[model samples]
Target chain A: MRYIATILLFALKYIALKLAFVPLAVILWLCWITAANYRKLSLAKSDVELDKIDQMLAGIKDKLPMDAKIGFRTNIDPGRRGVLYFKSTLILAPRILENNDRDTILLIEDPHLQPVLDKNYECLERGGNQELNYCLMRRRN
Target chain B: MLFFAMLACVLVLFAGTSLSLTKTCGLSGPLRFPVAFALVLVILSYGYYLGLLFQIQIGILLLSLGLPPILYLAFEKYKSRQLNLSFPKKIGSKNLAVLLAILVLTIRFNKYVYRWGDWDAWAIWNLHAKFLFYPEHWRNIFTASLAETHPDYPLMLPSLIALFWRGLGFVTPLVPVAIAHLVLLAIPVTVYLALKRAMHSFAALLSLLIFCVDTTFIHIGGSQYADTLVAFFVLMTFVLYQETKVSSNRRLVFVLGIVAGSTSWIKNEGMLFFLVFSFSFLCFHFKKPAVIFRYILGALIPFIIVIHFKLKLAPANDLIHGGREKDLLSLISDPNRYWLIIKHFTMTGITDYWIMLLLVMIVLINKMPVIRTLPFMAISLVLVGYILVYLTTPHDLDWHLGASVDRLFHHIYPAAVYLFLLKFSENREIRLWS
Candidate 1:
């Protein structure tokens, strides 16, 4: 009886471990297919302009503290502009938004918006060539 | 290095708390790890609550003070087994099965990382983490302008992220990713341990793989939402409740209460599950009143934390705030809402893993035992509660169903599978298959 019990236990353990691999195999295949499709779509949507926006934001991020609030202004087309500013915010994140506030860091991406921003804030820094002009500002008051 | 240091501190607190709790209940070995981990999470969440209410320094102090006695007790327990902390009872084929599950889940989690989680992750959970990371300005998140972000959602996930980032002295997107992967891995680990305790090793491991690989579990678990975490606590509550039935250990009952109550800190749905668990325990075990008291006492530990958060910290939940009578009236009058929920519930289960689910359910029914039906009963009640939420949801019925029905079902799937496997393990006739 003891022998039978021990054998039964060993066999069950072996079977359980082996059977588990079947699901593991299935999951691997599923993940592979999912990753393939995801990578393809992500690669297709990759943007150089968005990368530049993020780069500019990264530079600003190093200068600001964790608690700093950032305001955004951009003339890139409404949809693409939102994407650019969103990518910029992702650099230092959590404190950046499109709102007016005291001691705010204004991120201006177009010269036209600069006139409006210049009324309320002083330019802190300006960068980028003619094709992608931008400025950083602080609230004047 | 900083991340590891902070994680080590949290794990020490978790291990000490869980091991001490297990010893208190006269339980030994690895099973206690998952339960202890869950309890520690609730405690850490409470610590976060303290930080929000008072000074962050005080919260950090409280968190730091919590682990020493618990660790001592755990050390005491381990010394008895010739310093063998390996938990030999937990070893065997189950570990092999668990290992394979981990490998598969690791791959799945990698995919999740590449995609950067789903919408609720970025917009809600991770966004909240950013807020919590700024202790001084965290309250800004609840301002009227941020209402769309659901500021009233429970803070367990964000609090945990903030706790780790504070240790590292900075925030990064990687924080949420690491947290998500840990939680994703935790589900299978917890399930395996809990099932091993409830049933045989083979049955436990088989159920663990099935539970882990379910398409819905894999898909939404990566989304970094509170749902998967909520599911873990819900399942743990059941697993702990099963332990209480086999042993007359009142500590186990108390632990069950803690697990069930901790759910509320995860999501509002967890609060509903806690109530259902309470009501089910009362209805089923009214003759055994101490069981009820023990469970309620355990639950109250976490419940106090939740009360502090809801009353002192969080905004009133938007779903519960206004036009309730009108919504209820409209929901009752419309038969279509009921059908829509039922249809989606059935359809999502079928498409996710219907063949396996149906087979398990049928076998469980055929071999159903009279003992300990309350856990299943509690889950059924919670499902009913979910449906009612849909019926009276302020959002559009179609949109709400489309968005959440599958994820909501995923919440209960693992526990349900665990129950069926427990039944399968218990049935002697089914032993022929092995």
Candidate 2:
């Protein structure tokens, strides 16, 4: 009877430990999921910025076609280190509308040209549906 | 430095010739002949540097330490040839290529990562090296200096580092750190090859991959901790045991005895592995009661010598004693703490991978028939033994085990990885590229 009772107690302890594993697994899964989502969101924001640059180039008619997709040469945020999104669309013949800016326009996309854009380029706008969207403009010293 | 390099080159050339000679005699594969040769060369080079710093005669020591194995291999070859027994070089070149790639990757990453971890590496391992490099401060080592906090730790790794410092005349401690990193990389490769010979290639490759990326293993490897070196010797001993068991080669067993002794010399926890291995081997191999007693005595001889040197010549400066009466009393008073220690063993950063593999192995065990019953049983015993160690210990469960989960796990990692891989490979063969 004593041996049986001892065995039963041991079994109960084993079960309790095994039960704790569920919560442990759940917590780990939640952390991994959140990290994955954050990475995806950051990457998507970069892609949107490249799209805006393309739109600005399209709005300004240089010899470059308005439909050209511009890849991001460099990503710069002037005021903050947080994630930012930008979009650009080509307006007809000679105008490029940067989602972040309307007045300061830039040249159309050229395969051979490497354009130097300041972090505070006045024509870059944030166009994503998120609440964090904002436009880039040169800050006066 | 130039002299050391030149000596290393000479050792490598000589070891290479020796390996080729063994290959010609049919001891190992034609493809593995070069790989084995190169590894021996590297080990000799490193060992020579260590031998020089410790004021040991390098040539005589190398010949004494390395020659027995070479001679044994040659004898095996001769015996096999005389008996007309066909020796197959089952190992292939593709596996060697993968190993080389992994080694190169480890080297590149070791160069890039400048940061070391806390606890054993920074506090004990690196600190010891610092003292050894600047020997004028040897007295400071025993003093209550901030650097001598964990003086209870063994000196094998720091001694190696000191040798590198003395031989190369380099001021930066990163030289030894890099060497330790290389050993860490080489260990998994060596263990994998050893496993490949005993089991299947796929099993070996998968085990190696798991070891390399396993968060705990990677963390230890990146730091200056002696755990990786300890695991390396443990695995080497296991491999030697398995090889000798299969071949009935007494000489291999003797070499294994030395390796096991070296494992104990690496750290205090290493003695546990040495004890476990000695007990298991004796029970498994010896049929007669008298022979078993003799076998136990033979194994204990090297262990005794190592312990004597550790206690008499280089006693730990810290307060902890190896065999204190108080330790025994404390253990007898509280047993529940032991079980709590066992519980912590289940917790790990990469628990998900471990769980998935465990589940897969369970399924495989049910499905596979040709998978020998012995390997499964052996692995299960090892896992159970690991858990039981925590439960049976007399130390404060939370304070002792909880504080050093990584170190505790690392000490037994070789056995754990081996057992895990054996179970993982039950139903399927390893597919390297896939």
Off by over 4 Å in 2: A1-141, B1-10, B13-27, B30-93, B96-112, B115-117, B133-148, B288-305, B316-336, B349-399, B419-434
Clashing pairs in 1: none
**RMSD per prediction, one decimal?**
8.3, 22.9
Residue-wise lDDT of candidate 1 within B1-434, one digit each (tens)?
Answer: 65565566676676566556656796676777777777777777777766766765734545464557445756676678443333344334446667667777867666655333566775677668778777777776666545556778888888887777776787545566666766777787877877677657887777766755666677788777888888888888888878878876687888888888888888888898888988988999999888889878988888888887788767878767775876688786799888888788778778985844675566655656634578767877888898888888889888989998877777777777777767776775653222
| TM-score, per-candidate, Cα-based | 0.78, 0.55
Residue-level lDDT tens digits of model 2 in B132-240: 5443333234332232245455566665665455556643445545655566666667657666666667767766666655655666666667777776766666555
Angstrom error at residue B229, model 2: 1.0
Question: DockQ, in order, for the candidates?
Answer: 0.10, 0.01
Please tell me which predicted candidate would have the highest TM-score against the true structure. 1
Best by DockQ: 1
- Each candidate's chain A: what TM-score? 0.52, 0.25
Model 2 backbone overlap count: 11
Sequence-dependent TM-score of model 1: 0.78
